[model samples]
Target: MASESPEMNRLHPFSAVTTTLNRGIVGLSVPFFLIGVLSSVTDAVDPVWSIYLAPIGLVAGVAYGLTYYYRFEYALTQDTFDLSSGVFSRRSREIPFRRIQNVDVRQGLVQQLLGVAVVTIETAGGGDTEAQLNFVSEDEANRLQREIRRLTAAANGERSATEAETASSDEDEDEEATSNETADLETAATPERHSDPGVSEDERHEQPVDHGEPTRLFELSSRELGLYSFTSFSFAAVGGVLFLLLFANDAIFGLLISMAEPLGGPANLDSASPLEYGVFGIISLVNGLALTYLFSVVYTFLGYYGFQVGRAGEDLVYERGLLQRYSGSIPLEKVQSLTVSDNPLQRQIGYAGLWIETAGYGPDSGGGSQSAIPLARKRRVYGFAERLSGLERPSFRRPTTVARRRYLGRYSIIAGVVVAGAFGLSLVTAVENWWLAAVVFLAVPPAAHLRWVNLGYYVGEDNLVIRSGFWKRRTTVVPYYRLQTVSTRRSIFQRRLGLASLVVDTASSRTFFWATPTIYDLEYEVAREINETTRQRLQSALRERARSSDSEDGDAGVSVAFT
Candidate 1:
């Protein structure tokens, strides 16, 4: 029996409501406000006319939503996933199965309430998502993800088989006539396999592939979550508080004055004792820090609540979030490298995070990378990274001593600039004791030494590990097979100091920015040697991987023939 062909489908009907709210209301909000202001300023138009615009905009929004809903369509064809959508100008896209990298499903608060989800598809080499099916039924979103995965796997298998057969044929042609005769004899003796009569080609290809039961790898406990939140120390929270104070200074000052009335208010501050002044200042500083910490805790909890990670066959599956749920998979085969990262606070508390960097953009990821374990014990995080990359914690080799001098000079310049700026401002303003600002210079030496201590790299048998940064340290492990390029770099100062840096580039999008993995300020000769050795190792690893893949493909082909 022939399998039915897939038909074009539209988004869930509730999508129109979401579209109206997200697009229509947001689009008209500014114009509506402007019209209302115009009516109030000039009596050329009645305020009643401005009121009518609300219903008019709502109707326009609904009409636009219905039109958008009708125009958008998607279908899963035999070879490609097709989409067509337009409001003013028509646009269409066809994405081939083999090119698809990931299919992620996400549901924001509104979509969750409406029982709908957004399906985002990503492909290799793109900086953004390849396709998004906005507002589909939850079940339909899952079905699409499964279907796309199955088709992609089948397509890749067929392509690999074809290439293998071609390579085998070429090898056979290069052999002597005696070997060819033997091969012909073996081929003639082997029995030919026949397909089942009832199974169509489409049905055979569409047969479900078992991904196996998910093995839970990690889960964030409530206690650990709290600790993670507390230690994260988001600067965004502090910035938000500062911004609020900037915009609402009068109201905030009034409240502060009312609260300080018991302390004789701001009016009596001139006559206050030194002890009283110290206490008041301490209380204010503590209150500000506490408020910032509270904001950070709330934000972290909302983003990471109920975080869980599991392995399902060839992919690592993760689900996280409290209000807006997200579920995605990291394809093991596509992973470029693994990064173990921790800030100063996390390092002190013996906790760190594991990040997975892949070949293409990840849904809601930070530059082609996503957190595999947001927060875990240091030992556990290192263990997980080793399990994936087969490398233990490396003893990193520090850079040349001159690198430390370079850092000291760099930090001293920064401190000098800061102090100069403060002193200059004091000279202009009514501020006294401008010389006290030189205290910043005292921190420069320690800061430079700490930076030098944190910067190091280790060249392993099959992986390259580079650790760097003092405030937000990251230890990245890159397998030779995943290496794309290796080069040495030197600045004018580095050249003068006989120093160079080794940069290892990967397919990760993070490399597009200046965040490419680098071993900083090594001896020039050492950097050159390592760069050459790494390139050689990269070639060897590629060849080994190719042989391994061919062996597995041959085994799979044999099993299929026997079946």
Candidate 2:
């Protein structure tokens, strides 16, 4: 591969055209669209002038693309990958092999057309500290990522061997030097002697598991995608329709009226009979809904058309997409938490999705949590979560049945406030119907009861499990050592009820709601007990890891999850 070439290499020359075209189209699309709208609505400029702008933009884009192609250069070494790129002020970055956390290969519409892919390198340091080689051949992109993985593994193995050798030499020297010391002193020093100062905590804990070859975990079938299209929420479709209405309402309505003119369309609602207006409204709504649903199905299907997930060595690999394929791998050890989600409707049909939360690559990463299983049965969800988490089926300690009253009370207060306001307004205006408010009040009790039943917390042998959400249920499993903060909160209502909420915070931010995974409506005493136990677990896990690092045997006290 050219990436493996000893000399610094530039991207495929054709990248210049692709990059320029992609950026220019996206950057100038809005302005050009506005110009078109203005030209149609008002004769601001001759139609021929608009045609000239396109060629000018294309020429400028080509020039910029050529400059970028010449300026970009990258080199892959045994220990580091260096990248240099800048049009005016040159900037260079060196990403050490050891710090690389993830490698992703993406082929967008433009890259696909150009027969190239973009390779993104993300490091453990997080944030915008990432490098991208935007125009490598698809094969080279994959090969480059594999090459980096191989080099990183080799470097880690070499480091481990060196540490083991150093530890052995130190043990021998300690045995010789302590020969004259008392037996008790020698025994104490023996334990401390095995602790190699050369090994970092992460290295000591990273004991390789014997998974053998890459194992296929799950793949989304066409049937499954069809099921997901119906079960999965597609809010984007609604947003698209709203965007069309907001930006091109006049053009869209005009087109619709023109199409319906032969059928006695009510273009002027004021001149139409009541029945005609009603028929027109119904047609428009049905058309909008049908369009929205179709758009949603197509968009969702295209995004996850050929999803495949597997375990490759110590990493979890995910590859999906139809028109623009995306491939990424996450080290198993970087997974901070595992989650399973299913809405009430989905749960009824025995469908749920499994997701993993990794450090840095959280909700802001665009895709939210990385999906392990896009769509699966409930049993598969538990099985995959267990395999990924190295934990048996997750179960809660207790359902907050006792807190049903608290939930009902809080919800009743909210419902009452709405009902009272509506009742007051109804006295002055008939449109603010008191009966409508009463109908909403009727649903509050059931909603509160459902929430109470779903809220629970479990203190497992190796993990802390939190379950909540009734309509869209979510179960979060996080290791004790991964916990960054554990706290108890008391709302005024909960405080009055002698109850507190236990919140478990982990390094994974994808567990979004940023409200954290909380166990709500617990007795104050029980909450305190759980909090204390969680803290002890964290300390114990940390100590065990420390002991593992100090042991001469590689597997002495290794955490099962990391292994």
Candidate 3:
């Protein structure tokens, strides 16, 4: 066990009380639920005994909380953040400053009431939070965030200086051995340096002057939030409500019928005409959908209330949420890709959202990809993406006509199956308008054509752009150096159609549930060629970046020596 020093800090004393309450609620729930079940099933467990479980659990929780509070200690060392925790078994962890990617502060309702917050530290290549302080003074949390950022910046600066010195030493030795040859090499490289198209805007402006003040990039207004909520309707919310209704249908219908009887409503649905049934079903569905939409609107409002994003030195900082506040920073150096996304409705309205993916951050750590701008105009989003990624908007190449044929065949088969099913049902039932379902066939051609038109890929000088998805179109921009793996995959159906998908994997690509950055339904040969070309370009980009860094380091060293 490590002895406590002046540098070591413990959580706020009130953490014991909050921890007790949190644990007590959880501990009491299980026993009370079990007691209720046992009392209903048998006479062995009395319902009155459930009342005693609360105090017992509370006492146990208080004891555990006290122990845990005493056992936990943390300290900030020069190069690492050290933690000592565990009540029953001792465990210690040291997280290096270089590995830390983000330091986020979050406060739930209970914590807010208590005037404390949870501080989570995310590290490189980890799916979950590397370390968390459950309950700390809000001031302490802020201080910790600032301290981590300062330390990380200082560490990185020192590393860069050391590398520059080393590179300068190596260059000096090379010049001494071949001074004439080095002079000739420099002459040959001068023109190539000026005309290198592979050099990115970021490389040109490697380090921007920092004023120590955050630059606000975007903010969400109430009107725009509402518009975004309504346009980005979540079918998942509707499905959840439907799922709940399925299991509680009997009780829900009985209550509804009882309420209707008071108003002298229809006594039996069985005696209604087919037309009446259709009207009733439509009314119910419309009502359900309206309720679902309202729920989604409220959910979105709560989640994104007072949302804002800004650039703070080398980090992108964001703060959001109404009830559970979240404030976090994303290290710009770790960013892997940027995505501009919009639904068909939003696209028509000229609005979109921007999302950023960073290494070691995902759904398990609060959210999959952080939203740089939750809602904005399409042009504003594109401009922001280009500025952050250092790449211009790309001109996309549409898939070949063969890919369009595949989509047509696919949607047509789906329409055929649905129409056939409806016709078969009409033969067995008294319904007369089953042929109306054939109208689905009328949509197949347009739907297939729209899907093809929306799918495209562009290989830029320093980045790869992929645009896909019909319902929620996303234009993903992945820089060449950020690309982890590039491959061509052919599904069984795609193989039959002689088509393949080019998949570009990055550090954060696998974190989301949707497909990675992919160009789907391309010619097999074309996909293979793209795959190989992307790999070669990735290698070249890395080499170019390395040379650029070395040249910068040498220049710095020369200036310092001259001074």
> Which candidate do you rate higher for TM-score, 1 or 3?
3
- What residue pairs are clashing in model 3? none
Candidate 3 residue runs with Cα over 4 Å from true position: 1-6, 22-60, 124-126, 166-213, 239-277, 363-367, 423-434, 491-498, 509-512, 553-563
lDDT of 1 by residue, 1-563 (tens): 01323578899888877786766775456457878789789989776665667667767776777788888988887768888898889888888876776778898997788889998888785677888888899999878876776565455555654655655543223223223332332233222111223222442222212443344567887877888888886667888778776786666655654555566444345676656666556655666788889988887787789998865444567888889898877666678888998999999988898988877887754477877888888877776676567575588899988899999999889988988888899989977887888898999889989999999898887788999998789999988778888889999999999999998999888854329999999999999988987888888776765664565444322212111
Per-candidate TM-scores read: 0.79, 0.78, 0.80
User: Candidate 3 — number of clashing residue pairs?
Assistant: 0
Off by over 4 Å in 1: 1-5, 20-61, 166-209, 235-251, 258-286, 511-514, 553-563
Which residue runs of candidate 2 sit more than 4 Å off their true CA positions?
1-5, 19-64, 124-129, 159-213, 247-268, 272-291, 362-368, 424-432, 511-514, 550-563
Residue pairs clashing, model 1:
none
lDDT of 2 at 549: 47
Quick one: best lDDT, which candidate?
3
TM-score of 1: 0.79
Local accuracy of candidate 2 as per-residue lDDT tens digits, 406-525: 777778889889988988888888554476777776888898888887776778877888888886788888888789999999988788878889888876655334347788878999
**Backbone clashes under 3 angstroms, per model:** 0, 0, 0
lDDT of each residue in 430-535, candidate 3, tens digit only: 7779889989999999999999999989988778899998898999998887888888889898999899999899887344355679999999988988888888
